[model samples]
Target: MILITGAAGNLGSAIINSLLKKVPANQLAAFVRSEQKAEQLKKLGLNIRIGDYNDIASLDNAMKGIEKVLLISGLSMERLKEHTNVVDAAKRAGVKQIVYTGVTMKDAAVSPLKVLMESHFQTENYIKASGIPYTFLRNTLYAEVIPFYIGDQALNTGIHYPAGAGRVPYVYRPDLADATAVVLTNKGHENKTYQLTGDQLYSFTDVAGMLSEVSGKHIAYTDVDPVAFEKHMKEIGVPEIGIMISTGFAAAIKQGDFEVVTADLEKLLGRKPTPVKQYLKAHYVG
Candidate 1:
């Protein structure tokens, strides 16, 4: 069976939905951290298994007889530790192939989000060392991150963020999910790392323009100091930790860190991924 952790999450649910079209329901496993969430997945006629990265015993049970596994990165700054737990559990469960979602530009030794990239690299190292065949989906910034980052403010007072004028190869999570499910179900992806991204690159200013055009509002991108940005985020009740992480990503973009879109994504999915403009319209407008 193909096991998917974080099954209740957006990307996980999308992956499951995409795989269902190509694979049988009995061949799918929804690995969740909570039994309550498992119940939600159960309604979809899936084999729900309770598992947590922290609980090795639960992970072992979740992976029983499962040949392929999708190891969605756990949320939080402590992603490295969380992934280590997953790697250990997968190894013990004797899973054959593991597909992990990592970040794009992770090979760069130094980046603004070193903490985040290092976490993926560390887990990638563990997966390789375990002697288990693995596929690393080195994904770019999620296009949907914009809505979460600025939607409330845009709805409130038309305020946005510290995105500056930098461009990002903002990928849609659903597209990434499609490619991820394909790799997990198909062969020849073993030991390969795919840098998944959208069809083109775009900037925060570009996003604001699209939103303005779509919503027929005068939304604008404002530039601010990093310190001021964090302060504003905290004042707006964004957690201190979350402020740091978000600001760090913005800083990375300002340095032209995540602007490259590779051919690996199209090669893997055997189709062109959606463009950022189309994604913005589909998700934000309609």
Candidate 2:
């Protein structure tokens, strides 16, 4: 059976949904911390394995009889430790293969988002050292995050940010999930890494134009100074940490850190990845 950690989460659930189309529910096992959180998966006839990344015993118990594992990265201050716990548990369980979700920053040393991505780099190294056959899905920023970057009042106040003229190949999360499922069910992907990104590059200016066309509103993009952006976020009651995180990502974008694009996603799906304009139209149009 294939065990999927964080099975109830957005990306994990999407991957499960994609997996369901190709395999039976009996072939799938969902690892969740609480039974209550897994009610939907349970109703779907999946084997429910109770576990937490913080609890190695629970993880080990969950991995019992599991052949392959999808180690969905955790979001926490203790992310690296928790990920190591999962890796260690998988090691003890003798899992045949491990698939990990990672970010698509080609050069972590020069990327402004290095601090945020350090755990992923460390986890990748740890996984390699564990002697387990693995596949690393290095995913780019999701197109679903555009709404968050633009904010609720973007239609009126325009896309105000400090991303500058740099572009990103913002991929759709569902497409990434689909590719992950393909890797999980198929072979010849062992010890490989794939950069999951959109087929096209786009900047905030391009996003505003698409939104304007889709929503019939004159949306615009303003490349504000980083200091001014932080001040605005602070005045709007954004937490200090949130402001810092946003600024860091903006700096990375401004430096063209997310500009990489590849045909890996298209090759996996056997079709072109969804365009940013299509996504914008779906979410912005009535």
Candidate 3:
């Protein structure tokens, strides 16, 4: 059976939905952390297993008889510890191959998630050493989240950020999910790394221009002072530590930290990824 951990999440749900089209329901298994989530997956016709990242024993039990596994990265502070447990359990369960969703962060990138990038790479190394056939899907920033970064505040308050000249090759989440489904179902992708991203790049200025065209309003991208931004974040209850790390990332973006381009995603999905403007027009204008 092909098992998907963190099965109730967005990425997991997308992968599962796509898999249902290609594989039978009995061949699919979902690992969740609660009865509510289990019942939800069961409603979709999946074999359900309950487990948590904190509970290694449950993970071990969940992995039994599962041939292939999708190890979705966790968002917890103890992520490394939790992911390590899955790797160990998968190995002992005689799983054939494992796939992981990881991030693509340059060592020099200045973002709040830089520490997360370090941990991700460390986990990649550890998984490699474990000797199970593996695929590390180093995903780029999601186009879905670009709006949150831009928000409705951009329409009324203007787009204010420290990302000066940084460009991001943002791909839609469903596209990434489709590429992942391809890797999961097809053979010959084992023991490889794919930097999945879009065919084009867009800076924040490009985003503002698109917003202006679609919304029929003047939406400006402003290069704001980092100190002012930090002060505002503090006033709004953003933690000092969060502000410190985020400031670094925002500054790094100005240095072109997220400026990356790749075609690995298109080759896998057999189609062009969704354009950023399509999402912007639908969500921002309507």
Candidate 4:
């Protein structure tokens, strides 16, 4: 059976949903931290394995009888160690392959998010050193987060941020999950890396235009200064860390960190991935 770590998370849940279409529920296992979180998976008839990435024994039990594992990266200060714990447990449990979800960056050394991406780099290296066959899905920014980036009052106040003219090939989350499922259930993907990105790149300016067209309201993008953006976020009650992360990503976009577009997602899904404009129309127009 294939085990998916962080199965209660959005991406993990989506992957489980996609995998159910390709394989029986009995063929998949959902790994969560608690019995309460496994309720939905239980209703789906999936084997719910309660485990924590930090707990090697729990992870070992979760990986029992599992042939392959999808190691969703964790979000924490101890993320690197947590990922290693999962890898170690998987190795001991004799998992044949490991699929990791990592971030997509053109160059890791110069990427503005290098510090944040370091854990992923270390996890990838750890997986490689573990001698387990692996597939790395280097996923780009999710299009689903555009709403958060633009904010609820974007249509009224126009698209105000510090992204400048940089473009991002934001792949839809479900598409990534679908491609991941394809890799999990298919062969010839072992020891390979796939950049899961949208087929087209879109700047905030382009997004503004799309929003205007979809909402029938004039919208514009303002490339504000980083300092001013931070101040505005602070005035709006955004936490210090939130401001830092937002500015960092804006800087990364301005530096063209996420401008890389690839057909890997399309090839895996056997069709073109969803476009940013289309996603805007569906979510904003309604």
Quote the positional error of residue 252 for candidate 3 in Å: 3.6
Model 3, residue pairs in steric clash: 110-249, 111-249
List ranges where model 3 is wrong by over 4 Å.
108-112, 239-248
Predicted candidate 2 versus true structure: per-residue lDDT over 172-267, tens digit per residue: 889999999999999999999999999888999999999898888899899998899899899989998788788988998989988898999999
- Candidate 3 local lDDT, 70-169, one digit each (tens): 9999988789898899999999998999999988656633555566566778788889999999999988888777665665667776788877768888
Give the winner by TM-score: 1 or 2.
2
Candidate 2 all-Cα RMSD: 1.1
What's the distance in Å from true for residue 101, model 3?
Answer: 0.6
Candidate 3 global CA lDDT score: 0.84
User: Model 2 Cα displacement at 166 (Å)?
Assistant: 1.2
Pitting candidate 1 against candidate 4, the one with the higher TM-score is 4
What residue pairs are clashing in model 2? none
Give the C-alpha lDDT of model 1. Answer: 0.81
Model 3 residue 229 distance off true place after TM-score fit, in angstroms: 0.7
Candidates sorted by TM-score, best first = 4, 2, 3, 1
lDDT to native, each model:
0.81, 0.91, 0.84, 0.91
TM-score per candidate: 0.91, 0.97, 0.93, 0.97
| lDDT by residue (tens digit), candidate 4, 175-270 | 999999999999999999999999889999999998998898999999998888888899989998788778888989999999888989999999
Query: Which of the predicted structures, 1 or 2, would earn the higher lDDT when compared with the native?
Result: 2
Local error of candidate 2 at residue 208 (angstroms): 0.8
Model 1 bad stretches (over 4 Å): 106-109, 153-159
